[model samples]
Target: MLIPPRVPNRREDGLLHFDLLPPLSLYVHIPWCVKKCPYCDFYSHAISSAVPEERYLTALEQDLEASLPLIKGRQVSTVFIGGGTPSLLSGDAINKLLVILRNKLLLTPDVEITLEANPGTFDDDKIKAYREAGVNRLSIGIQSFNQKHLDILGRIHDVNQAKRAVEIAMTHFDNVNLDLMYALPHQTKDDLDADLTMAISYDPAHLSLYQLTIEQNTYFAFNPPDLPDEDTVADMQDMIEMMTATAGYEHYEVSAYAKPGRACRHNINYWLFGDYLGIGSGAHSKITVDGKVIRQTRFEQPPTYMLEAGKGRAVDEEFTLSHEDLGFEFMLNALRLTKGFYPEMFEERTALPLDSIRPYLKQAEKRGLLYRDPTIIRPTEKGMLFLNDLQQIFLPDE
Candidate 1:
């Protein structure tokens, strides 16, 4: 029932033009967390003083209002409010924010609205308030249930707090996603098994299982923890696939799993190379318009973003994607799916013929990393295991 915006012409001035615009999603970022995790690197600042909720919300509204003209007439299919812990805001704040979005944007009747919550930051009433605010879905950041692992990861919530958060989320929302990470420092197979068992016990609609990795500029990178070796991590992944399959979860994406018909639709739009407008401090956006694909970003700092937004221009950077950029970027996202994508989808999203990636396809196939017939293109098992290498094959230089 999703209706896409249509373009009258196919091409303009030798530039790419979409006959039908890809499905669009909306992302709102809240840039404050009670405390930053040691291994985290997302654009989030720890709260030293009381959050300027009213000022920040005003900035978000202004930011969205100014960007509406670019996405005029397009129906938004999904909305995901992510963060530095968006749950830090009060339920009334969330209500006001969604009301503004609803008033300004053309959201579908059944738009899947999601807000990310962290343990220790929300109670049952807050969770209930979020649900009442038209947020139909909740994604909780319950990184681990093990006390030792939780401490090692420097998470703000304790084991009991994690369980309480999930219990509360399940009480209010039917569609919920739990974010868990495995392959932690000094974590054992039994430890992971216990965590997975605890997560499945709730029968949540979806689960996002991730392998912990130390990223540059994070505390963990400077003082690296004693993580399990590569082979052990591989075994842990295999164990996750088997366990989740037994629990009726589908391994849809590399780091995402879900029950039947419960996949994260907003994220799926991303994997399909669809367009999304991201608003807030340090948020990024991919938009298709004027016969071209453009990328945009807002200022990273909260104060700077609010000041810029008040001036009716919150975006700090913008650039159009080249043909090479299109081909590589499309595959970069599409190939993450287990079922991969169809040639028709590639053409629709990238506005480029499948012929553009023929050489890269052949190269990947030659290395036994890809599978393609006339109708579909997918990554083989080996390809999924070595996903980074497979995605790198389609790089512009390659």
Candidate 2:
């Protein structure tokens, strides 16, 4: 059971309109973890008892059913099951979820479905069942293999578990991504070197390497650790990029690398500002309807989400993005690509003309924050290093 979405009284006037629609995707969030990681800012609750998997799955079905009106004629090309630990669910549950999705949505035959699995949360049997359940990609969170570093990061798995998890995932799936982080407290050049070397050795199809940033409200934020200095972190990033390239990986997005034609389709859609329907607790969604761009989010708390979905309306907040705000939000996502997006994308995705933000774009190019081209739009290498300033240009002055 689902209800129609609540659209605002505002019209698409004073905003750009689109004649064509962009690609569509789906994102599923599972918000429970064995323990809360100190550095994670994602909405994940640490569990003391067993996860309510069956009930959660039922709620997701209703949530998705409610979103059907937003994506009526489009075909879903990718589905990403990401969260606290999607792998924590039993394989049978994953199978049922996929079956439920297929029955409700028009998914492409070669749809790329990805699952985020923790090293200690899954086994060989569970993973193989996931493959059987239509998961073609597996993103294993192997932040670091060093036991001491793992402890510092509050990760439960050790080097052995990380290696074994990758091995199991690779055995069943062709598209495997290893999520690794660098710049730890007391981390040395040698420490990072060892981690990179180990990661490259695994030969994953994709790698998401990120720096350790202490965010607000996390444990690390309260009791900050001595992370690598700015220069060291930059050097580490440079080194990883060079090494991954040498190992035959393409540095596509800021923190993502992939083999030939192996980039994550779901993420690429997001970076390209493609539309997606996100279901489950705390999941966020952006969709286009009648040339207007609208965004919505379900209740952040799992209990609240379940209750709301049962009533056929799960959205806690919904708003139509203003023309001024759409330009800034689109830039935030598109600028993350190593190669800048095409000019056509601005109009097609945001339904706004490129000239709407031209003044800010000129400012960025004048400040040497971006390289402007008549045929293509992308950031200069300098812009890549200072992305925040480049994207800030598109932000409206309030």
In terms of lDDT, the best-performing candidate is 1
**For residues 348-370, what per-residue lDDT tens digits would candidate 2 score against the true structure?**
78766677787778888888877
Residue 387, model 2, lDDT: 93
Q: Output candidate 2 Cα RMSD.
A: 5.1
Instruction: Give the clashing residue pairs of candidate 1, or none.
Output: none
Worst 10 residues of 2 by lDDT: 1-10
lDDT of 1 at 233: 90
Clashes of each: 0, 1
| Best-performing candidate as measured by TM-score | 1
Cand. 1 TM to true fold: 0.96
lDDT per residue (tens digit) for residues 283-340 in model 1: 9999999888999999999999999999998999999988777888999999999989
lDDT of each: 0.92, 0.89
Cα error of candidate 2 at position 398, Å: 0.8
Models 1 onward score TM values of 0.96, 0.96
